[model samples]
Target chain A: MDGIDKTDRKAINFSEKLERISDLWQPRVIAEMNDYQFKLVRIEGDFVWHDHPETDETFIVLEGVLRIDFRDGAVQIGPGEMFVVPKGVEHKPFAENEVRLLLIEPRGVLNTGHAGGNRTAQNDRWV
Target chain B: MDGIDKTDRKAINFSEKLERISDLWQPRVIAEMNDYQFKLVRIEGDFVWHDHPETDETFIVLEGVLRIDFRDGAVQIGPGEMFVVPKGVEHKPFAENEVRLLLIEPRGVLNTGHAGGNRTAQNDRWV
Candidate 1:
């Protein structure tokens, strides 16, 4: 409980957490384990094509659908499902409707990877 | 997708995954993110008080309820809730009914921690 707040000791409703945020693309830290942080983000439409060069990125769908496009092809992930994009792979994430998901990655890793642009978000911003 | 398999690209239904295993206390790897592994396990009743000395352990309730008893008190986590037990903190987990959840930690971290007893589980056994 060293890094945890009193709110964490209570049940964290995924649906409720999603309802708390309306912004898209920015990830808010919800929990941390070891050097990794669990973040919640709402995404819709198309995001910039990029890749995390230093670490793998995990995407776990809490609601709606997620599609990750690679050079070769694309994969659609649904609720209760998860996908891990390996390091250094150029890929883009897109969602038709609003999607809520949890991303697990090392601290300091950018959401947009090295392709910093307008969509790049500030890291470690908790909700 | 270097560290991923073809099956990983597909949506992984948590309930369907739970239906595949019937064992208690034994965790089965479901997904991997970098050096961490997402494991699922069914637990009920009381478990030995233990602690992980090197890294924090995460408990995300996929179904049912989880109660983690700490030295000071206990916290009951319901479905969709999560708790992080910091390294070196002694604690015990209990459930009145069967509980299904995800345990995210570094690969090779023992479920039983330093208190290796009969409850100690085999690691990296995928479901």
Candidate 2:
């Protein structure tokens, strides 16, 4: 009883966990590895331009298309693809359609990063 | 040119990277975030029983099925599913068919972990 429970040992399914999220842009924690957290988020439209000065952020597309626009260029990520945004680099994410994403970064990382505002979601919200 | 190059900023496609791997059990690094790395691997049959004493390992299944057997039980991961094998927890991975996986772990961690053997692949082999 002190060790991992049977439920905790089960695999984390993206589609199953995603069904619990009803809001857009708000990320829900699905799993963790060391100090990092794997978050599932549904996003559409455009996101604020920001940068994590302390750590890099990873974006893995599970469904739809996601385009991250940088100062100089942009990268489009579809399902089955991923992109890593380096620390201190400013970028904005845009999706014309609803996109399901798996974001990986250190715990306590803000969705808005340094560009804090109303767009900043409550951190550590697990589904 | 001191910053990220155009080619480096492109999205990393899992399927495209996986096509280059012709061997089983050998993982090829596709991208890196901070000190961590994202690797794509094709695995079948069984793997060595091992444990990483220093860090946890993440397995995201892209195709086929993957079963990680723990001391108490086992967890099966399929496409769009993931499991984090905690550090120092001995486990063995078994696949009935070819399983394409995306592995996330700190740089320098081997496929066999502390259980060094013929299954130990050359570290840092990038696709």
Candidate 3:
């Protein structure tokens, strides 16, 4: 079928997703569709408190234990677990062990959580 | 802390994504944001050749080997690998072993590949 279309989404591998992030706290984009982007991040220990003001972000844990502390409730996401933090809701993420996670969010989302800091990354650094 | 915004995307689990699908050849919507949708599918043997006329689809292989036969060449993707089939391209997927995958594409994507089939499904199924 020369002109037949595959309605199925093309497959993307995770190892390549891992190749994009080299350090903790920094995330690099692996793929993008329309206005949304998929990112991969490696983390260990505590990260600064932050929030995206305009978009909700989704996290899928491929490895390790991850904890998210919110005002009313906190959630611990382990291997295979995912959570979405609503936009503008304050939260902090901490991982005692090294973790590999996939993030889906909009483009230009700040890494420092919100606004500015020396921790804020200007451009995505690929691994 | 009571008011810290978590910077990490809240984690969403895959087992839960699996619970959303019930049969083979059928794809179920597990989650969505904006115009894009995340789907889970269980597939086996040969599927009808088809394509998405508008949006490019993304596939992430969670288990088993999947073959996407393109016009000029074909690719076999296994666990942890992914492939993005460009839009308006003719292709068919097949698996000798049962395959589980994640589909990330736009809403209202036709399952029969490009158009109508006795197999075309409407409304996402939740298992």
Q: Estimate the overall C-alpha local distance difference test score of candidate 2.
A: 0.94
Query: For each candidate, what is chain B's TM-score?
Result: 0.93, 0.96, 0.84
Worst 10 residues of 1 chain B by lDDT: B1-10
Candidate 3 chain B: 10-residue stretch with minimal lDDT: B1-10
| DockQ (0 to 1) for model 3 | 0.33
Could you tell me which 10 consecutive residues in candidate 1 chain A have the lowest summed lDDT?
A: A1-10
Candidate 1 residues B1-127, lDDT tens each? Answer: 3544545566667778889989999999987887899998999999999898899998989888999988777788888778888888888999999999988999999988989989999988998
Model 2 chain B, poorest ten-residue lDDT window? B1-10
| Clash list (residue pairs), candidate 2 | none
Over 4 Å off in model 3, which ranges?
A1-12, A16-21, B1-11, B16-20
User: What ranking of all candidate models by lDDT puts the best one first?
Assistant: 2, 1, 3
The CAPRI category of model 1 is medium
Off by over 4 Å in 2: A1-3
Which regions of candidate 1 fall more than 4 Å away from where they truly are? A1-8, B1-8
RMSD values for the candidates in order, in angstroms, are 2.2, 1.7, 4.7
Candidate 3, residues B4-104, lDDT tens digits: the string is 34443345567676766668888887666556677788899987878877767778788889998886667888887667666788778889999998778
Per-residue lDDT over A1-127 for candidate 2, one digit per residue giving the tens place of the 0 to 100 score: 1245667898999999999999999999998999999999999999999999899999999999999999899999999999999998888999999999999999999999989999999999998
lDDT of 1 at A48: 89
Task: For residue B60, give model 2's deviation from the true position in Å.
Answer: 0.3
